[model samples]
Target: MLYYTIWTLFYSVNFHTSMVIMFSHINHKPFLGAIHDSLSLLFL
Candidate 1:
């Protein structure tokens, strides 16, 4: 039971990390674009 619990926790953490990484990657370009646009607008 202890081993199973540990394994489950490990899998959950791994899955969560992968999801975060994937989401960051997916949004990275758009996020950068937004920042650039905002900065340019402020400068203008």
Candidate 2:
């Protein structure tokens, strides 16, 4: 159930949008924060 929920949320954003948001976020943060942000994004 949880996995499906996550997948649905991810799909709703789609791939390219996710990548664009991810890179934009990575650009503003420090290295550690970027790593954290990236991991968080991936899980979502």
Candidate 3:
């Protein structure tokens, strides 16, 4: 159960990171910094 939980968390973060990257590519420059902040928040 613990392993499964960890895997899920990792997967979610990875997916979110990819989505954020894609959005940053197509969106404004400000959004890139905003997502970096968000990703740091997620890590914490």
- Candidates' lDDT values, in order? 0.67, 0.71, 0.81
The candidate 3 region of ten consecutive residues with least summed lDDT is 23-32
What's the true lDDT of residue 23 in model 3? Answer: 67
Q: Output the number of the lDDT-best candidate.
A: 3
- Per-residue error at 7 for model 3, in Å? 0.3
Q: Find the candidate with the highest TM-score and give its number.
A: 3
TM-score of each: 0.63, 0.37, 0.65
Model 1 misplaced stretches (Cα beyond 4 Å): 29-44
Q: Per-residue lDDT for 43 in model 3? A: 96
At residue 5, candidate 1 shows an lDDT of 100
lDDT of 3 by residue, 1-44 (tens): 99999999999989888778776776755776859866787799
lDDT of 1 by residue, 1-44 (tens): 99999999999888755655565567775555655654566589
Per-residue CA lDDT of model 2 for 1-44, tens digit only, reads 99999999889668746665677675975556665666687799
Total clashes in model 3, counting residue pairs 3 or more apart in sequence or in different chains: 0
Write down the lDDT that model 2 would get.
0.71
Estimate the Cα RMSD of every predicted model relative to the unseen true structure. Answer: 11.0, 6.7, 3.9
Q: TM-score of predicted model 3?
A: 0.65
